[model samples]
Target: MSDFQSPLEAFLYWEANSPNQVFLKQPVNGKMETYTFAEAGNESRKIAKALQAFNLPERSHIALLSKNCAHWMMADIAIMMAGYVSIPIYPTLNQDSIQQILEHSDSKAIIIGKLDNYATQKSGVKDIHKICVGMYNENDGELWEDIIKSTQPLETITLPSQDQLHTIIYTSGTTGTPKGVMHTVGNFIRSASIMKQVMGLPHGSRFFSYLPLAHVAERMGIATHGFVIGAEFSFPESLDSFASDLENCQPHIFFAVPRIWTKFQEKILEKMPKKKLSFLLTVPVLNILIKKKLKQKLGLKEAKFIVSGAAPLSINLIYWYKKIGIEILQGYGMTEDCIISHFNLPNDNKIGTVGKKLSTVETKLSADGEILIKNNCLMTGYYKSPEITASVFTEAGYLKTGDIGEYDHDGYLTITGRVKDQFKTDKGKYISPSPIELNLSKNNNIEQICIVGTGIPQPIALITLSELGKAKAKDLLIQSLSASVKEVNSQLQKHEKIEKVIIMKEEWNVDNGLTTPTLKVKRNSIEKIHQPLYKSWFKMEDKVIFE
Candidate 1:
């Protein structure tokens, strides 16, 4: 393998060396559409030529709104080859967010691909050129297929310099409006190189790209890393076919957030009741058989590396997966750092921590306990927001991560909570809600939860029960949750103890604006929605307040 300076060079190298090797397998219209290295390279070049024909200025931003697809990757590569910065928008975002990102990034054109609802998304934009990737009936843009067939491929590919802007990824805002994080080609190369060295994935390793590619973590971990290591990438047809897709791909490396891991646990327990599965595992011979069979059934028997990130995972969930012969290593990083900060490695793994800092990264705790980092892969800054960008870094030049964390003796870092998420009570004592939430989430009955106590005497929990929990009698569900709440409260300080656990009447989700696209709880949004009930819930005599 030859050393490459940029991502385009890497793609070209694979295209020349392994022309016929399958690079992407995308399920389209109930059929698999495969793209070889040469095909993807050729298509991207054509797209680049079409983009150049538009005569946009150098380094103009091109926006892409789509779910995970092969066309999404092709568009991104084309944007880079045409000397333009790619700005990806989450497909699930509402019209307001879509309009905000488009205007903020100063995007000249947008490529619309697979989305849940395009009519609403398209109506929000006022002025911008639109290009349709697939079959869309709207009269807004030219079809990608038409451009590829008519336009000639670029005679020469303009590879970007290390310092040149590559993409502007908007953060998935859990608290407020999203910021456009600027990343250069050098940042991605450094991060991917470090990841390649750390994981040591063999050539032709299978990668299933189910997560939104717009997110930096998915882009770096699956798309960029796959290209760097010459891995085969596969995309699911749709959410309905996710299971079959996973089974078909049987990926060598798998990455998912905590919510997905929890869902997996629920699915397994649904098939085989926890008590029965526990009993079978107690027998020596049955234990081995059951573990192997279960992993195979879940299509993770071939996975060499399993990672969970985006949000804090419960320690008990990790232990539960370990019992089934799958060890999930939790990683911690943000968009500003190219999502390559800390990760747990095999064998040297710490159960509850996000693991030690990566070899290429430097980290230290701030005076106020915030995690500060200085690394080669850090983003250039927030696009067009120099003041805001400057505020995020410390005087010592380290990125002042809003998250508060601590390191153990061996240098394993445990995320205690987020500084922004901490709240004060009427008693004037501050509380971090994440640790308490993690403890309560260990209860199999709890699906999702948020702890809030701002301006109140004692903290309160708003919880959404799991399917199993909801199937049981209401009294039984409350009893189980009460026991779990008491157990968690026993470990907390007096001011931090939860006063009540209120069962939420409606499910919180992305469509409902209660959760982010990545499934992180939108604490501010949830609080606002339930603000009216706070006083009434506080006055309730029962410890578990069920609606």
Candidate 2:
């Protein structure tokens, strides 16, 4: 059970108990700005007063548009304090997407802060009431600091009922249009309680909040959990200062996506060649010293829990980090579940799997092998879409996770692939690309891979080269990739074997509309773009073909 009834109650508890303690540490133009619990509460109350002064209806939906920053959390608190529902939008979303979510969620007002490009996105807000943060130089609406300085504090705090609407987190739209996932105050409380208990989080733990707070993983893991334990949050100034800021904060609990982990590995390998690093790790004293240096460099030396999520990370990459004394605990969850499905604890970690189910989570497999989940923290439903929401759950009321998986004898679950990601070749056999993609990604040269066949004779691997691969000569890259294809093919069935490896000239990214903000590849987009070329690519004489 949670110590407090709601997130606001937890925040109030911390404010009363640890008023003078630092709650948020944000880096601005190389300078660190901190807000104590008392100070944050004061600002939040002032913002709440400003919102109330607008005369919005009770329980009106208010949207939060910002990158992960101190003000984003404050704005969320302000929304809750004003007795309104919060709707968070991904900062990386295009203008149309921003408009879609705001209109779909029926948000009355929006609090914008710490955005990279507000000029292009400001049009999406249209005539909605916007409270912009001046700290980031946003001028499209009423200034945040100006209101805080001018408005009086809201004295009356409104506590939400257990089942009252809390927030609507819109999906990243990798599949289609973004759908708002409606969560209640009780969901946040239960999720926070589970995270605090499962991780043994301390009151004063330092949290580095770099991931998009709009994302459920970051929102629950950092913001909600921080309020529960009075944790100190540190935000990077920008991408350029992320390394320095993280190093300075030395956060106790750190979470990053698989792409970020890969980037860190690439950065380390840039300075130290893979072969040399492997050789040095064999020496006892040097290995310990090197691991310590690596931890310090990655700003994880003080981290108690380091986790990777959002997508499947290669087991080889996990082992690579293990060699350097960092054990990445890979977990599994979705937006609908509030990310409380499964996690690998530090002591009970199962390397290849996404760990066992959380204490309160019940998991089972469907007839088709899809993972089904039921937990106290699950979202009530997708906002404004009853039919769509009803379709995603089983008749037994479990959330159909859409991902196929298997449970080992020890109850550890390994995700094989998504049910929708399976495709059939012209030969009539359906193939799951995720496992093949995972195996092929073990080659350090391959950065991203999407196995496609659809209506072709056999599946072909479409890939973008990694930094290491890009730096190598063309012949060397071909030789290396060919060997990988041959090796991976040796383990697969004849019908499921990849016929060719096609190296694409362009990389799939958020900007290209080929990847989600969390960096998960849009398999549908991949098929749409390259399905016609699959047969031709498969007919190529060479084992590896550069596009």
Candidate 3:
């Protein structure tokens, strides 16, 4: 193995040493197109040469607008090979967000590929040179196919210095407009090295890249790490083929958000009822077979590491998986630090807490119990937002995580809530919604929940039903939810008791602007639309009000 200094160096090393090894697998029109290290390198270099032909300034910002696909990774390499900074925009982002990121980053060019809806988004890329991937049917601009045919492969590829800027990753913006987080070559190398060591990710591992490669976690954990370790990556063609693709790949490592884990659980439950599964698991021989079958069905039979992050996974969900011979390690980190904060390893697994910090990571709690983190892998700063960046860091240089957490005696961190997520009731009692929401999520019927008490005397739960919940009879759902609400309130203080459980008819999602790209509920957006009706709903006679 070569001692690589940067992501580009890692790619170069593999391209030189093991050119025949398969690198990328893309499912195109139900057929997998495989790219070897040599082939991928050739394509990336050719794209880099074509980009140089555009005559953009050195270190010019180039934006990538696409979902997880083979060309996205190649484009990243092309940007680096061309000595430019990459800016990745979330594919699900609206036109306004796309325009804001491109304009703010001052991108000279954009590589658009593999989008579900390109027509609506192409209007956002005005005045920028566009290179579209024709394979994915994104042909609004200069085609990628023509560039490779007409251009020569760049032969004078130069390695980037550690201090040179690598990419600006825009946050998915759970609250407000997304901010560009600046990361350098050194940051990527350092973070990837630490994570590769900590997670024991081996050379030539198999990775399934379904998560948005634009996000830091997926960027570092899968795409970047795969490059560093000479791993093979397979991408799902679309939502319809996601399960089949994943099942076929059976990746060694799997990382998903809490929402994805919950969806998997729902899918499993839909196939096998809870009562039948419980009885089957109680039998000795059948239990092993059932667990193995379930693992294979979920495409995790060969997974060496299964991780959940981006949001707190419900502890009950973890326990439920544990009973089925799978242990989900809930890790914690944000985009600011390149997601090098903490994780629960297999040997030292903790159920309710996000496990201990990485070897080079430093963590401390602030006066208000907000988690503060300091690490060499942290981002340089927010792009074009110096004042906002300065405000996020303490005088001692720790990033204020905004998440409220408490470390157990042995150092496992349990996230209680968010600092800004707290709301004051009319009676002057402050309520942190996260912890309450986590508890409420234990109810299988509830898919999403937010606790709000802005103008009311008591906090009320705004909830959307899970598939299991939606499939149940109205009377059954009300009875089950009412019991859950009663059970949760019984364990809380008088002021903290939930006033009522209001089941919202509309599900919060990215299209509706109620959730982030990662599926985290946008509390601010939810409050803006529903707060006015809170009082009226609170005064209703029903304990479980269906809205």
Candidate 4:
């Protein structure tokens, strides 16, 4: 049970100690293909040798575009094993974003994993080393299958040091163009070590990898940290079969984003409507029965812990899952910090806060109230973007997190809103919009809520109701939002309150660039989209005017 020193060290160690242990499982053509510890390390080393023989360039960056698959993980490990930095992008990103990230990162090669249209995306990029997996037929560049045949001998496995650069993860780019966050081997080791201790993740603990592998959530939550702790990773075929995969894998640890958590919540509420679930309260026996039934449906019967991250989670969402016997804990972190900042300790649980900061992780509020973090996991700098990196960190070395938060007396941190989101009214009261918006948007009827009142008298909500909250059932959504508003507004000061509410129609998504990939509202972008509507609505005094 000695420390492995680095991710690459962990890889070699696991291969030697547990060569037959299944390290990675990929669902290929609806069948499972498990890669043993020896196989994962052996395949990755071969890819690294192939990359070296190709002789791309020195300190070159390799970009990987794919979902969470074994090949993607192996390819990523290849980049590191070959002494190259890995720049992984979301598979959901469009062509322009794909081009921007590659060009910006100055990537020399691109590895394509299982996707519907690999050739289509490969054709668009003008100048870059392109290779595709599962493409046995002849291609200009080496196929992943053929490349792994030339594995570098275990004795020849060369990788960067604990302090050397390991990976560069791009921000979701919700605000603008994505920024490459640089992380080193030391960062990965420290963050993973802290997580292993905190979560008590065991060696060879099985995990299901379904989140976007390119993002920090999957990078740390599954690939980097999960593997470092000797956890086995399994890939889902696709989102459509995520449930079936979960049931089959029966992982000890589960990590999911907020949207998936909400969907899981919706599944529970759908079968046992809130009213019916509430009706069980009269009988304690019925409550226990409901918990067992919900747990069985979510395929979390074997989960040691269900962790939610990558976005802010509403308290109501946690409470809903709590009723169904899911111990959903919220974690707060970012790409720059390797996806761990705070998490609820295993023995103690809190709903709103993301829980205690990791041991030896330094966190404090700035003069403007932004969460500042200083830890071993802080990035070296933005890849080739020193200016931006310098700007993100202060003279004290703590990252200027751009998020506004407060610490409860017990040391748990509750995020209040974004630093830039605190808008001033004409009357001089500063409004925190997200808190109010989250309060109202908690209802199943309200799918999204964006609060805007920039350069105006007071705050106003621009909400988009769920499909079920449409014209026919408008009263239901309105009832939920109105009651929520009244409850939240009651706690705020007069000038800090929302003056009125306006319902919106169009859905705002990160794909459309209206929201970040993590689902945080791009308020600046939303302002542009709703400018004309805001002007028209400003002239009127009515609330809830029919569109």
Candidate 5:
């Protein structure tokens, strides 16, 4: 396995060793459809032959548009085993965004999953081959099954160099357009292996993957290491079914973004109040009892790790989970770096810090405090945009993370803010909105909150309340939310405190341009659209409580 030339090669070797092991599962028609490594490998071979039948040059680009389904993994390895590059798009993308990515990547063919919104996408884009999941609508392009059946299994194909591009992950540009970040196989495999070493991802590690696989986080968190290590991966049929799915999988290893972690905390605390539960744990004997109760509630009694990343996590939430015997660690990474840069090690947990640089990567902080990352995990460059790529790296060799980070005496790294998200209050105090926002939104009822007021006396919290919690927590909502925000406000300087709160009635979604498909807020745009009204809304009161 160590001698394998690339990640895909290692995966192929694992498949040969344990062909009958259950490698992947997908929900079809609300029922689980399973696949063994051998079955999946054979299906991928069919797909490779199908791709080769196009008569295109070797390593032709193929795009995968789907949610976290077993087929998405199948299509990816198929592309790799066939010596083609895979460009994946989130299944939630709008038709226009999908077209832009497919067109931008010059994908020769697009494999799509069954999504209601994308039913019309087959004929919408130009110059790209289209195939649908499950069945053929005559108006839609060819059925996915039909294409695989048309070709015999590929016998031989030369794999690309380790440094060759494997995927182009497109991310939102600060300017509202998107840029494709290109990564090579070495970058991906090495990053994935770092997680394996940091966490105890020995063979047969159990993992449940529900995040949008198009994100680099999932690409490395599940698809990359999960593939090479032959982990048991279970997919949630849909977001609504995620809890049921998690209960069923009860994976030993858990990795989730801050938003999802927040949701998990929210869901748990909704049934059991965190503060009351914490008070009950004041006694040593009761603490263990409460911890057991919490574990049973989370269905994670056996889960060894619950790591949070893809954004800043609130320290209060981390400490709260710790009180219940759950170790919630933070990770720091970006698409440009193939998703892993820093991880809070198990024995080395610091509440506010993201963690130390992975053993496989080296990091340095510039005099100005910008993080400089250099690793095999660093991407080749932004696809077709050398100017931007060149700007992100040092001529001497380091990827400028654009994150303002600092290291404690213990070597753990804490991210203060994005260099881009730093804002100055009218009082001239510089404030980073992310940490404050994370602290304030610990209330399970507030789904998302963006801190605005770059040029004002203090920040204002524009909150998108969690509709899921509305019906159940109706009477207790306001007091609960105010208490949570106040607790977070205690940690902030007087100038950095939120002067007011605005609870939004509507959800800020990707389709609305408020959030990226990955759920990170488009802060600049949100501020631009809402900042002007701050004086009228915030200055009039200290707290705008929704009655």
Candidate 6:
């Protein structure tokens, strides 16, 4: 059972028990600003009183647009305490998307906090009540400091029930337009209860929050989890200062997506070449010293538990990290599932699979091999899209996760590919690109890759080379890529083999609509952009085609 029914109740309990304990830390300019439980609770009550002064109808929808910061949590708590639904907008979204989410959710007011570029987001937005968290121009909105100072704290706290609507999070939209996924307070409480058990962190555990707070994984894993366990949440000032911030905090529990993990590996290899490190590890005494030093340098020596999610992690990457004494556990979940479906626990972990389902969640495979889940943590539905919501579930009420998967004898789940990502060739042969892509990505030279061959005889790889790969001579790079491709092809059937490799000059990113915020490749977008080049590349005689 959960200790508290709602997040606000959790905050209040912590405040009453440990009013002087620091709960949050955020960097401002260059110095760190700390917030105690008492301070945060008082500030939230003040903001709630200021919001109630508007006298809007009950259960008003309030939108928050900001990067990860201490004030962002304050705004979220205030929204819930005021009996309002919180809609979090990704700070990286363009003006058109920001406007569309605001209009779709029917938000009555907006709370603006720290952002990279506020003008771009506020460009087309007007006629809405804006409450700014920090410094802003007069035309932007009302100042947060001023409003909180003028208003009194709420005399009576409005406690929310478990079934009440809590948050409506909009999907990052890797395939198409974004949709709002509605989750209730009960969903959060139950998910947090299970996580509190799984993590087993003490009251003063430290967490570093760097990912987008709008994303479900960060929201539940960091924000909700911190609130429940009374953990200290730390936010970095900027990307340039991330290394220093991470080392200074030395988080007890760390979570990162696979892209970040790959980057960390590249950084380490730059300091000590892979060949030398491998040779050193073979020596008896030097191996322990080298691993300890490497972990300390990367600020992971103090991390008790590390997790990687949001995309498929290559087993090679997991093994590489393990050599440095950091065992990364991979997990699987989506926005609609409240981000607590499956996890690879310590001491019982499998390298390739996404681990077993949580004790609270029930899972089964559909007739077509799609993974289906039913759990207390599942979202209520997509907001305002009844048809789209109904189509995502079975008549028996299991959520159809769209990804094809298989289970091991021990009930561990291995995701094979997406149902929509599979394609057929002119010869009537179907291919699943994920397993093939994973094998090809074992090459350190390849940073990002996608396998595309919808209408051709055999599949071809579209790759964005890493910095080291790009710096090498053209002939040398081609030689390395060709050897890796041949090794991967040797394990595959004749029809499933990749005929050629195309080296792409352009990079894929969230800003360019090629990847989601969580770093998952937008396969549909990639195919649409590169499909026309397939025939031309296939006709080339060379096995490695440079574009």
Question: Best candidate, TM-score-wise?
Answer: 3
lDDT score of model 1?
0.88
For every candidate in turn, the CA RMSD to the true structure comes to 1.3, 1.2, 0.9, 2.5, 2.9, 1.7
Q: Is candidate 2 or candidate 3 better by TM-score?
A: 3
What pairs collide in candidate 2? none
lDDT of 5 by residue, 1-547 (tens): 5645567886787788989989887765578889898888888888777777677776778998877878888888888987888888877777788888888888898777646466555444567666666631233466768766775777785666888888899875444678888888877777777767677667777788877888888888778878767787888887677787787787887787667767777677677676787688898889888788777666577788777887787777788778779898888888888867887777877888988887767889998899999877788888888898899999768999888989988899988778888888788888888788877766767788888776678888888777555665655666677677788788888988877778776678777778887778888778878777877775575475441
lDDT of 3 by residue, 1-547 (tens): 8668999999999899889999999999989899999999999999999888899888999999999999999999999999999999899888888999999999999999899998888788899898999999878778999998988899998899999889999998778888999999999998888778886777788999988888888999888889999999999988888888898899999999988888998989888989999999999999999999988988999998999998888889999999999889989988899889989999999899999988899999999999999999788899999999999999999999999999998999999999999999999988898888999899989999999999899999999999889999999999999899899998899899998999999999998899988889999999999999999999999999999
Query: Residue 12 of candidate 6: its Cα lDDT?
Result: 82
Least well predicted 10-residue stretch by lDDT in candidate 4: 134-143
Q: How high is the lDDT of residue 403 in model 5? A: 89
Q: For candidate 3, what is the TM-score?
A: 0.99
Ranking by lDDT: 3, 2, 1, 6, 5, 4
C-alpha lDDT of all candidate models, in order: 0.88, 0.90, 0.91, 0.77, 0.78, 0.88
TM-score of 1: 0.98
> lDDT tens string, model 6, 327-437?
999889888999878899888799999999998888999998999998887889999999999999999889999899999999999999988888887678889899999
Error of 3 at 230 (Å): 0.5
lDDT of 1 by residue, 14-108 (tens): 88899999998888777888999989888888988888888898889999988888888888888877888899999998888899999999999
Count of backbone clashes, every candidate in sequence: 0, 0, 0, 1, 0, 0
Q: Can you write out model 4's per-residue Cα lDDT over 447-523, one digit (the tens) per residue?
A: 67777776667677887665546633666555666777777779888876666678765777856788776666678
TM-score of each: 0.98, 0.98, 0.99, 0.93, 0.91, 0.97
Off-target runs (Cα >4 Å) in candidate 3 are none
Off by over 4 Å in 5: 120-124, 135-139, 148-150, 172-175, 274-299, 426-429, 443-445, 467-494, 539-542, 545-547
Better-scoring candidate (lDDT), 1 or 5:
1
Give the local distance difference test score of model 3.
Answer: 0.91
